[model samples]
Target: MQQGSQKIYFFLAMTAVLWGGNPVAVKGMLGEMSPTMIVLLRFLGISMILLFFMFYKYGKAALPPRKHVPTLILMGFTGVGLNNGLQFTGLQYSSAVNCSLVAALSPAVTAVLAVVFLHEKLKLRQWLGILISFLGVIYLIAHGSLEVIKNLSFNRGDILFLASQISWAIYSVLGRGVMEDLSPMATTAWAGVAGTFFMVIAVLYQGTGVTFQLSNFAWLSMAYMIIGSGILAFNWWNEGVSSVGPNRTAIFSNVIPVAGMILSVAFLQEHIGWREIVGGLWIITGVYLATRRSSMEPQTT
Candidate 1:
C-alpha cells in the first residue's frame, strides 16, 4: 500500500511537471508556428509514437470497434484538434499563468456536467464545493476585481482559455466510455488520425504556407509538448489513476498550476498577482472537497 501510494505521488508529480511545462512551451511556440499547424504536428507526432508502442506491446495495432469509431473520430477532433487549436489561440491572447490557472477549473466544470448531464446527485458539501470553486473562477476571471468582469474588461486570451476548458469538458464526458472500449493508447492514436483532417482544414482555411526553416529550439519545444505532455504525462496519469483511484489521482491536477506558476514566472517572466494566488487556492480546495468521496470514476480530462 505504501509503495503504491509512493508510485501514485511520483506519477502524479511527473504529470504536474510535464503538463506544467506544456503551456509554457506552447506559449513559446506561438511566434514560431501557427495554432492549427501546432495542433496538426502534435496529433501527427503522438499518433506515430502511440501506434509504434501499441504494435510493439500487443504485436498488433488494434483499432477501436466499429460502433465506437464515429465517436472516437469526434473525440479526436474535440479533444486534440480543437482543444489544442484554441489553446494556442488563447495563448496568443493571454499569459501562460492565466491559461494554466484557468484550466485548473476543469474538475469543477466536470462536476457540474455530471450533475446536469449524468444526473448525478451530490451532497450538501459537494454543492458547497462547486459554489466555492466557481467563486474562485469568477474572481480569477475578474482579475481580483469584480468591476472588470462587470464591465467586461477581461483579456481575449482568458476568454479563449475558458472556451478551451469547455472543449476539454466535452471531450472528458465523451471520452469516458471510449476508454472502456479501447486502450488509452489506441484511443489516442485513432483520435490523432481523425484530428489530422481538421488540422489540414485549419491550414487550408488560414492559407498557411509551409515554413521548413524553423529553429532547432522551436522544434525542441514542439517535441516536448508532443512527447513529454502527450505521451509520458498521459501514461503516468493513467498509471496513477489505476493505482490509486480517479478521485484521489485528480487532486494532483492542482499541482499542475503550481508548477506552471513557478515556471511561468521563472521562464516566461509572467507575473502572478493576488487573484491567481487566492483563486487557485479556492479552486484546488473545492476540487478536493467535491471529490473527497471516491468512486470508480474515470478521470478522462
Candidate 2:
C-alpha cells in the first residue's frame, strides 16, 4: 500500500479501537457519575468543539436554515439524546462486553430500518443476513438459553441496548435527509447541541446534576469520552472516509466490537464465554453480509 493509504488505514483502525473503548469508559464512569450527567457533559463539550469546526468550515452557514431546525432536533433527540441515555442506563445494569457485542448489530439494524423507512428492497443475501443477526441478538439476550425465551425472560439491560440501537438507527435514517441540506459535521454539531438540550432536561428531571467533585479516574474517563471517543475518533473516521471512501472506511468498523470485548475483559475484569463469542461472530458476519455492497452495485471511485 502507498504510505498515504497506510496512514489512513492506521487512523481508521485507531478510530475503531477508540470506539471500542467507549462503553468501557462509560461503564467505568457509572460508578462516579450519573448517566444523564455523563451524556450531558460529554456531548456538551463535543458539541462546542464541533460547532467551532463547523463555523470554521461554513462560516455563517454553520447555522442550519430555519426549515431544517425541527429535523435536526429530532435527529438529536433520537440519535444522541435517547440513544446515549438508554445506553448508559443500560450499562449500569449490563456488562460492557454484552454492550459491545450487541452493538455490533447496528449495521444490520440500520439496514432493516432502511427497508422500512426508505422503501429499499433487500436482496436475499441481505434478508438472510438480517435474520441471522436478529437470531444472534436473541441468543445473546437469552444467554444461549431456549428456556429463557419460552419463559419470556430476558435481560433488561440487553433490551435497553436493543432499544438504544433502534433509536440510533432512526437517527441514521433521519440523517440521510438532513445531510442533503447540511454537511455531516454540521448536522452532528447542531444535532449535538439539540441533544445537549434534551440531556439538560434529562439531568434536571433525574435530579442528578453534576457534583463537580469527581474522582481523578472519573475525570480521566470524562476526558476520554469527550476527546478520545467523541472528537478524535470522529475526526479520524471522517478522515478515513474522505481518503479511502466510506466502504473501505466502514470495513474498519468490524474491529470495534472485538476491541471492545477485549478491552472490557482486560480492563473491566469482565468475563466472556461461549455466548459472547458465538453471538458476536454471528453479528459481525451478518452485518458484513447485509451491508457490503455487491459487485453489481455501482462502485464509488
Candidate 3:
C-alpha cells in the first residue's frame, strides 16, 4: 500500500478500536450516571475539547457559516443527538454484548443507504456479505430460541438500540453531501455543539441533575470517551470516509462488536454462548467479503 493508504488504514483501525471499547466504557458509567446525564456530559466534554482544537487550528473560521447551520444541526440531531440518546438509553436495559451485536449491523445499513441515496453500486459479493452479516445480527438477537418467538419479551431498550443504528445510518448517508464542503473538524465540532445543546434540553426536561464522582474508573471512562471515542475516533472516521469513501470505510465498523464482545468477556467476565460465537464469526466474515476489493485499481466517482 502507498503511504497515504497505509495512514488511512491505520486511522480507520484506530477509530474502530476506540469505538469498540465504547460499550464497556458506557457500561461502566451506567452505575455512576443517568443515561441522559451520560449523554449530556459526553457531548459537553467533547464539545469543549473540539472547541479548543477549532480555536487553535482554524481560529474564527471554525464557526460554521449561516448557510451551513441548518445542515450541521440536522447532522447533530441524527448522528449525535438521537444516536447517542438511544444507545445510552438502550444500554440501561440490554447487556453490552447485545448493544454491540446490534451496532455491528451499522455497516450493512450504511451500504444499503449508499446504494439508495448516494447511487453507489455494490458488487454481488458485497450484497452477499451484507446478508450474511444481517443474519448474524438476527442470530445474536434471538439467541437461537426460535421456538420461543412469541414468548420472547421485547425490551424497550432493544428497540431503541435499533433506532440508534438507523439514525446513525441516515446520518452517514446524509452527511456525505455536507462533508463535501466542510472540514471534518469543523463539522464534528459544530455538530457536537448542537447535539450538546439538544442533550441539555432533554436532560432538563427529564429533571436530571449532574453528579460528579471522583472514582478512578468513572473518571477514566469519561476521559476516554471524551478524548478517544469522542474526538479522535470521530475525526479519524470522517477522514477515512473522505479518503476511501464511505462504502469501504464503513466496513471497519464491523470490528466494533468483535472488540466489544471480547472486552466484555475478558474484563466483565461475561459468558459467551455458542450462538454469540457463531454469529460473531458470520458477521466478521461478511464484513470481510463486503469490503474486499476485487482489483488493485482504486475506484473513482
Candidate 4:
C-alpha cells in the first residue's frame, strides 16, 4: 500500500509536469504549423504510440469489443476531438497565461458537472470552493480591470478555449462508466486512435499546409507535445487515476496552471502581473478545497 501510494504521487507529479509544459510546447509549434495541423499531428503521434502498446500488451483482445465501439467514438470526440480542437484554436489568439488560467477552472467545472450529470453530491464547502475558483478565473480574464469589459472585444480564440474547458468537463463526467470498466491504457489508446481518425478529416478539411523543417523550433515543439504531453502525460495520468482513484487523482490537475505560469515566465519570458499571481492563488486554493475528500469510497474490482 505504501509503495502504491508513492507510485501514484510520482505519476501525478509527472502528469502535472507534462501538462504544464504543453502550452509552451504548443506555442513553440505555432510558428511553423497551423492549430488544426498541430492538433492533427498530435493525435497521429498519440495514436501510433498507443497502437504499438496495445498490440504488444493485449494483442487481439486489445481491440475494443464491438459493443463498445460507440462509447469509444464518443470518448474520442469529447475528450480528444472537441477538447483539443477548441484549446488549440483558442491558443492562437490568446496569451498562454490566459489559456492556462482558464484551464485551471477545470476542477470546478468537473465538480459541478459531476453533481448535475452524475448525481454526485457536493458539500457546502465544495460549492463555495467552486464559486471562489470561478471568481478567480473571472478576475484573471479581466486582468484586474472591470473596465476592460466595456472595451472588451472577444477574441475568437478565447471563446474557443472556454468551449474546450466545457468539453473536457463533459468528457470527464461522462467517462465515469468507461473508466470503471476499462484499463486506463486501453481507454486512452482506443480513444486516441479514434480521435486521430477524426483529426485527419478535420486537417484535410482545413487544408493547412504541413511542414517538416527540422531546423525550425516547431519540429521540437511538435515532438514535445507528441512524446511528452501526448503519450507520457496521458499514460502517467491514467496510472495515477488507477492507483489513487479519479476524484483524488483529479486534484493534481490544479497544479497544471501553476506549472504553466512558471514555465511561461521561465521559458517564454512572459510578464506576470500582480493580478495574475493573486488570481492564480485563489484558483489553486479553491481547487484544493473543492477536491478534498471527507471519505473515500470503496474501489471497484
Indicate which candidate wins on lDDT: 2
lDDT of each: 0.82, 0.88, 0.81, 0.80
Better of 1 and 4 by lDDT: 1
- What is the Å distance of residue 230 in model 2 from its true position? 0.5
Minimal lDDT window, size 10, model 4 = 292-301
Q: How should the candidates be ordered by lDDT, best one leading? A: 2, 1, 3, 4
Winner of 3 and 4 under lDDT: 3
Identify the runs in model 4 with alpha carbons over 4 angstroms from their true place.
1-4, 150-155, 214-216, 295-301
Candidate 2 on 112-184: residue-level lDDT in tens?
Answer: 8998999988899988988888899999989999999999889889998999999999998998898888877
lDDT of 4 at 75: 79
Per-residue alpha-carbon lDDT of candidate 4 for residues 1-301, written as tens digits (9 for 90 to 100): 9997987787798889788888888876677677777777888887888889888987897787777778888878878889988898777787777778778888888899998988988889899889988888777777777776567854567667678888888877767777667777777778877887888788889886666664557777878888888788887887776677776787788889888988888888888899889888888888888887766545532
Q: Pick the TM-score winner.
A: 2
Question: Which ranges in model 3 have alpha carbons more than 4 Å from their true place?
Answer: 1-11, 148-152, 238-251
Candidate 2 off by > 4 Å:
none
List the pairs of residues colliding in candidate 3: none
Clashing pairs in 2: none
